[model samples]
Target: MTVKENFELAKKAYEKWDIDIDHVFAQLKQVPISIHCWQGDDIGGFEVNQSELSGGIEVTGDYPGKATTPEELRQDIEKALSLIPGKHRINLHAIYAETDGIAVERDELEPKHFEKWVQWAKKNGLGLDFNPTLFSHEKASSGLTLSHPDKEIRQFWIDHCIASRKIGEYFGKELGTPCLTNIWIPDGYKDTPSDRLTPRRRLKESLDEIYTVKLDEKFNIDAVESKVFGIGSESYVVGSHEFYYGYALKNDKLCLLDTGHYHPTEMVSNKISSMLLYSEKLALHVSRPVRWDSDHVVTLDDELKELALEIVRNDALNRVIIGLDFFDASINRVAAWTIGTRNMIKALMLGMLMPNEHLKQLQEDGNFTERLALLEEFKTYPFGAIWDYYCETMGVPERENWLNDVKQYEKEVLSHRE
Candidate 1:
């Protein structure tokens, strides 16, 4: 049988449990996954002519064809988006501003700096998201920004964050979509600090100052991201998960959960339901981590599937904002984006295709045996057929066919980059 015939058979099988395959397809197509622009440039922004990475962040391996300019990065992103099957948004870091060959400090950034980006996003029919580049600058070399002891330095970072929120609002107003402005600072100690409370207090005060001006939520939303520890912050990280969770709840802002920002034993999937209970909305930075916070490319792993399942099962698709957050400079950048994004979409589709209501009913009735058996049976369902149908209907290449397009782009576009 052909792919469509197989999909029809699978659809009929799922109908036994009252699952609507067409509804799942319609919902999946409407979900927008924000693709991180840093992936195309290996997290090196266009703010300066730098040779090394800073702010306790590291990108290993010397991959060829890394995007060096804004135009190159956009070109690469267009190619990757062409192969992926969904409407999506682009997540931007503050350091990516096009300054017109003039030196523009972070604190002095204006909406006009990103006018080119706004135009580009409009032309491509993509929405925009923003982040404060709290690291990789001289101000952040001391392993602190908003939490720094020096009032001058802390105020500088606060001003930068405030500027970023304005830029985010501008993007949203221009593109007619709410842009999420996330603040993630790399501030901590290499050794245990006796004055931990001082830094946290400073951070709280700095955040208050940054958020003093309330922007309309229709144009922009604020989010705070946390990290367990970074390279130089192994001993202590001021903005840990608890800190952001409390801050977000108190301030009525969204808390962002980066998948690689936790201990090896902890899974972000388990935290989603709990977070949704307190916060009105939540943001996610999905990435694959091997043992530690190494920003590896995403794949169809068990945790990825579980994360997607939790979102679908809880009916929180509209409340949760999803974005990709990995940078693997060891391979082709365009292919990396295509692979990670396609796998993410695939994982979400798998979760949506599950008989979640039936499983919940079985669990509630204490029919553990049947629930386990049916779940195992679900593993063997023709999910691939439905996925292929999704790609075909969305007008994107199915499965391995996307790789051929990536390879072709590498030869025609990426390989020419010096």
Candidate 2:
């Protein structure tokens, strides 16, 4: 299969999906979903991270345990790849900071370590891409100390972050250019209220420095992972308006949005609409809800689930990279991970099936509210029914000669890209 052939094969599957949505919905009821990452590391040949996935298991996002070694992870990926049929892939939730002496598997931010866990992509036939994580790649600092508000301490924090930036650079240079190097900082403080607008100001200062002196293309996937909180007195970006920080920074960098970080009072769709208002600043990091915590998966909630799909309906979905941000140590890793991936795909497929009239309404509308209201009307429709129908009816199973087919497809796609 050529790249075109592979894509065509996928399109055929999707078209069948479009035609048999009702059938798909019925099948969903009949079939038990077989997802990746279940309880026990080796139960289903999953790479489990027990410490990382500690939480209530059945639903919330959590890791199970160390399922496999790099080799094992690769084998499982191949096995799973053999199962998946041209599905769009996102990432697993938060990858932790490394250990003390591991050989910084990826040498970008060396004196660091690399987990074989992330290596699954290489062996399993997947390509790496970007997801929102990093905000400012500054050097180390205590970050806005007033008593010691001297430039020295603040510089420390900036340098600390910049070290991470070095790691990012290393990734691009050494790791075949990571999909994107993401960062989220714990710099926001709240005790004395140093200032409301400092985080962005400091971030901008750091990024400008990296661009001029450190790396060239501004981190390629430069992004800000924001949250509304404080440690000593520094208030973070409190609302969508503060997104100006991202806009100010965004010639090439992205202002990524985290669904889990949104205030509980806010509607998920409203936040989606709000981000579109600042579309230049808004990149995406996706997950579902476990009450208050970010579950890092597609779930039963109609709002987030529907909102996740809505981005595709408006054609803005691709403006960002997607990743599930869940982490629990007790859950079955494969099952949970698969749920997130499967449902994320499902939600995305939903928004794509919106009517032409609806798309036109959104595209042509002068008023944001009206366009949103129009899109809001079909919340109940099985937007993904068509896609589900296609996959379920056709089956997610690999064809008998799938290895050869995938080899041919990979060869063609790689050839075209290079």
Candidate 3:
């Protein structure tokens, strides 16, 4: 059957619940997921002097055709964007800066280093986000940056973050959308720390200094991300959730909650409502975590659905800046991006299609039996039909047709890469 034919049948089922199918499509189109560029290159950014991946994060597998240059990375991003439905933004790190073979220190980075990126973004009509690459650098060798006891070391990272914010501001001004500049550092102790307070205190002081050179909020939005634990810092992390939560609340910064940054039992979906209550805006780094904080490709799992439901039911679509953060070098890089991003959009669509108000009323009225029944029944609904229609309308290949494009591109473009 035609994609539109299947969609019509699915539409009738959803209309019974008083859901606006057209409105859902429109809303889904408007929601932009910030796709991380590092996924294309396994977090190996283009720098004259590059360092090995460290700071508790590791990208396993040697996927051939990984982007080795700025132009190639952008090209790979364009390829992935072509397969995914809807317009999205690109997230970049400080290490992606192009200095024309000149070794530019992180603190000395300027907007000129990212001019090509801004131009590329402008050409594609895409928004851009920025991050200060605090890991994989000589200064971060001690697993301490911005929280180091040495004032000079902390100052270096402070300057880098300040510089990154300015670059984000530049992106916002160029793209006409406020750029989210997030700061995530890998500063923690491998074993139990006798002086946790001291490192946290230093981190606080360093952040204070970074924000001192204030730029226009209309251009750059600031965010701070925290991790429960990491490869090296299993015992204690300086930027704990409690630390960044309080810091973000008191300082008026957006707290970015990474899905993989929590313990095995703790879910980020449960934290969304509470976070939105206090902050005007929050951000997310949507990923899948295995036994630990392993950055696995996101799937349309139960937690993903719940996370989307939380954002949709709470009516915080605009309030929450959704972004993708995962790297899997095992599969085709472009396919990895396509799979993870499409699942994210699919999760959002599922949330919109749900009878959230009805379910809420049912719960409020103590109709738990009916609520559970409906929830379970809706899982078998024609969700795939609706998703295929979305892809058709968006002019992207429907269903696994996208995989064919990836395979063709692999043979034609990616395989040629040395």
Candidate 4:
């Protein structure tokens, strides 16, 4: 009937399994999904001397009203955040820096370039995350960055990454939350490499150099994201999953896993528990992949739920850093963010509602039939009711009503961008 009444009924259903409905809300509130800023601009950063989008990253569709300026991008992000349920962080790339129309080399960027961003984050009470933009630059024209054979090119990227970490540290110190500075380079060969070891060895050396400039862990945390293959590097990617996995362990860095960066059949959900066993902390770029590394918007699918279940059941919610990663220029950009982020929170909510303890006991007792049955049955539970209540409680639009807000914003704000 009403949001509260429906929530009450749903609460009773979950209570049967001894699930603390209030506790679930408390846990979910603590999770701050880092919403990627690139999505608002389709990865087109605000550099005065902007380069073409390269390095196996592609954003399709010529959607109208794409954010073209720093103020515009931040404004659009604010709009999306209003519709989202919980407090969240903004994930930014180095190219998004503002230099007052002066061309600042990536290697030369400093905290001053992002002073406005820090101020905006402070105003909004949002934590900030950082990424070293390794692609879409002249240095990466050959599709190699950290793993490039040329020592000069490798050093350039290393310098840029070092600068990025310092910026991240700035964000952390100003915002009172540690910033995650992730490094993902598009270094690979399209054709089978005659010698793969040289590139990977160079990459290892370059990483060793970058990590030498260490900031306090309380401010900036470092992460390395690996991709199996990209557009130009279908044959072999230098920073592969196995390579980064081993490197993260040895270096004590976090391995950032992108859901779209795996083989066709490989599931990120399956790897979370295993990675958690070894890594004290890991990061996730939650995006959907279709045929290849498509970087599609995340949906409320089986894999998303399973991924959330792993985090919730293993009690590693705080350990796994969750962030959204996908840019679809085809749809309303603000709506895209709203839908994907809401689904992520929804998946986590569903995971909390599950009888995880009972399910684990069933498996331990060899009760596969009951486990399977309950799992299927819970899929049709009163999940929507609880979700509606959450949105209402969090002071956002309930369900599809958020779409109306997006449409109105498109009319009032985004439509005027052109």
Candidate 5:
């Protein structure tokens, strides 16, 4: 049968469960996932005097056609977004600012540095998000930033973060959407440290100072991220989940939950409901972690489906902010973005097609057998047909057709990057 015929059948089948396939498609299209800009350059931003990636971050492989300048990166981003379905946002790091060949110290950065990005985003009809680059800097080489023992070094990072908030506000104001400014510091010790309390106290004080001047929430929202541990911070990471969770609650800020920032056995899907109870809003950095905090490209894995289900089931789609956070330099950079983003959209569509209310009713009525059976039955549903229809309606390639476009772009554009 043709694609439309299959979709019609699937739509009728879903109607038996009182599910509106059209409504699901409309809702899914409106949910925007912020694609990270670092994937194009493997986290190497165009900053003067920028050193090699440090502070427990590492990007493996030597992929050719990696973006080297702001223009190249933006071009690559445009190509990737073309292949992915639906409207999306771009997530930028502080280091990605266009400074016009001049050196701008991190703490001295201003919104003018990113005026070009604002203009580009405006032209492309994309929203923008911001992150303070807290690693790979001279002051961060010691594996400490906001929690650094040296007062001068700590203050430098604090000022940088404050500046980042203002830049985020600028983007939001220009784009007419709130920009989520997330702060993630790679501050911890490689070995056991007897003075953990001191660093934690310093970090708390530093955060307080950085957030002293609150920007308008309509334009900017603050989010603090926590990591279980990183490469050099295996012993103790100062921004543990507990620390940021408490800080976010007390300070009225959003807490960002990075999937790869927790233990392997811990699924971020389980933490969603609990966090929503206390947080007015929650931010997500969705990535796949093989075993450790390795930022592997995302796929339509079980965890991803579960995460999407949690959001849809709890009716918290508006309360959660979604963003991609993976960097794989092994393959085509543009394809990596396309694959991860398309998979994310696919997962959300699957979640939306689920009969969540019916499942809840079964569980509440102690009908465990029917609930388990229906869950298994859903595995064989015609979700692919619905996904293809959505893609076709959104004016993107239905399936592997996008791969051909990425390959052609690599030959035409990315191949000449050197």
Candidate 6:
């Protein structure tokens, strides 16, 4: 709704209800927001801060058809900022890429090379969001067929993280502000008999080494991008909802939601609802779908998209961190970032956005009402109309573009009045 329209609604509602309607108006102030640089096409290597949005691209992982270089990772983030240059900056929290040596490994980011990334971020103005995968991709290196069983594999990863911390060491200390370190281990299940691995307890212990350090220091929490999957179509540990819920309760750390991870099935909104039940202990994010694929391109999937927003609203939460969760080998970070952002908005359908039961609880917990307003804002989106009746059980926005499309709507209403 426009500023004037919003005020008018409040006036009408307040006259009838006698509620301090303006009490809910969120102060127009900068809120600490973050976006992951998994997509390089539109928003790679760039920092989006309330102050200035510019930074280097952050690319990672070794994919079959994907190709994103350090330069691309550097450029994407830089461009995202330049696209919306202004004061009160929108800082880049960090560069997030996997640990595939083929794309990015500590060795790939040699001392000087690492400095270049940092310097670029500093120059362009952004922070870092490190993923545990940034250290190694033995799985990918081994052709994504064999799992590394050598202690060196795990130890090497630990060492790389320590090194990253040393390199990332900032504020005269090790680590950066709003720093993010993610560890998504054998997060899936095994399919065959020959595939041997450590127990979940030991695996958690291994990841805990780093988690302990940060938690002890009370540093930035490393979000666990949990998923339920298996190798060769076999299920994995963190792949199922049961495992994820168990892990969240046991780990006592933040969990990141990857929308597409539960692809092919599962209600994204329902999952969001469950997670928010444990807010302050978790975070939310999205990645585009690839193929019948575990994680692929992020095109608009009707059921999935509607469900995702409902999940957000159901959880009644805001300040949710969004990122490119696409792990396709064919696409680069820039393409990933752009597609990710576009998908975020395109997921919404227009009409009167309203909070549901889940939102009410979220509001009660968050001590805020922006969740209500956000739903209303979504109503003005162009896509809402077509989807308005798609599933009327839940309220959605009417279809109308905020600009040109809305004008036509206005004329129709005026003509009927005359």
Q: Give the top-scoring candidate (lDDT).
A: 3
- Model 6 ranges with Cα > 4 A deviation: 1-38, 41-69, 81-113, 134-148, 162-176, 186-190, 194-198, 215-219, 230-245, 297-319, 327-336, 345-352, 355-418
* Candidate 6 lDDT over residue span 1-418, tens digit each: 5534444554454334232223222211111224454443222332111111111112335422222455544554554333221211122222333233334444233333345555666665555555533212333342121123455655555555554443334311232455544545433334543432444444455555644444332434455655544343344442244544566577775667766555556656566555666755445555544433245556666644664456444434343444445434354333344344344444532101333444566677994677766556644433332232222212222222212422343344312331
| Global lDDT of model 4 | 0.95
lDDT of all predictions, in order shown? Answer: 0.91, 0.43, 0.95, 0.95, 0.93, 0.42
Two-way lDDT contest, 1 vs 6, winner: 1
Clash numbers, per candidate: 0, 62, 0, 0, 0, 72
Q: Is candidate 3 or candidate 5 better by lDDT?
A: 3
| Higher-scoring candidate on lDDT, 3 or 4 | 3
Write candidate 5's Cα lDDT for 1-418 as tens digits. 8778989998887889989998998899899999999999999999978889998988998878999999899999999988888899999999998888899999999999999999999999999999999998988989999998899999999999999999999999999999999999999988898988889999999999999987999999999999999999999999999999999999999999999999999999999999898787899999999999899999999999999999998999899999999999999999999999999999898899889999999999999999999999999998888888888888888878899999999899888888
Candidate 4 stretches with Cα past 4 Å from truth are none
Selected candidate, larger lDDT, 2 vs 6: 2
Candidate 2's C-alpha runs over 4 A off are 1-108, 111-120, 129-178, 190-194, 197-203, 213-219, 230-251, 271-281, 356-385, 392-418
- Per-residue lDDT of candidate 4, residues 1-418 (tens digit): 8889999999899899899989999889999999999999999999999999999999999889999999999999999999999999999999999999899999999999999999999999999999999999999999999988788999999999999999999999999999999999999999999998999999999999999997999999999999999899999999999999999999999999999999989999999999998999999999999899888888999999999999999999999999989999999999999999999999999999999999999999999999999999998989998999999999999979999999999999999988
lDDT of 1 by residue, 1-418 (tens): 8778878888888788787988998999889999999999989899854535777777887878899999999999999999999899999999899999888899999999999999999999999999999888888889899999899999899999999999999998999999999999999999988887889998999999999989989999999999998789998999999999999999998999999999988999999999888877899999998988888999999999999999999999999999999998899999899999999999898898788988999999999999999899999888888888888888999869988888888888888889
- In candidate 1, where is summed lDDT lowest over 10 consecutive residues? 48-57
- Candidate 3, 327: how far from true, in Å? 0.3
Pairs that collide, model 3: none
Model 5 lDDT at residue 404: 94
Kindly list the per-residue Cα lDDT of model 3 for residues 1-418, writing each as its tens digit: 8999999999999999999999999999999999999999999898899999989998988878999999889999999999999999999999999999999999999999999999999999999999999999989999999999888888899999999999999999989999999999999988999999989999999999999988899999999999999998999999999999999999999999999999988999999999898999999999999988888999999999999999999999999999999999999999999999999999999999999999999999999999999999999999999999999999999999999999999999899999
Ranked candidates (lDDT, high to low): 3, 4, 5, 1, 2, 6
lDDT (Cα, 0-100) at 326 in candidate 4: 96
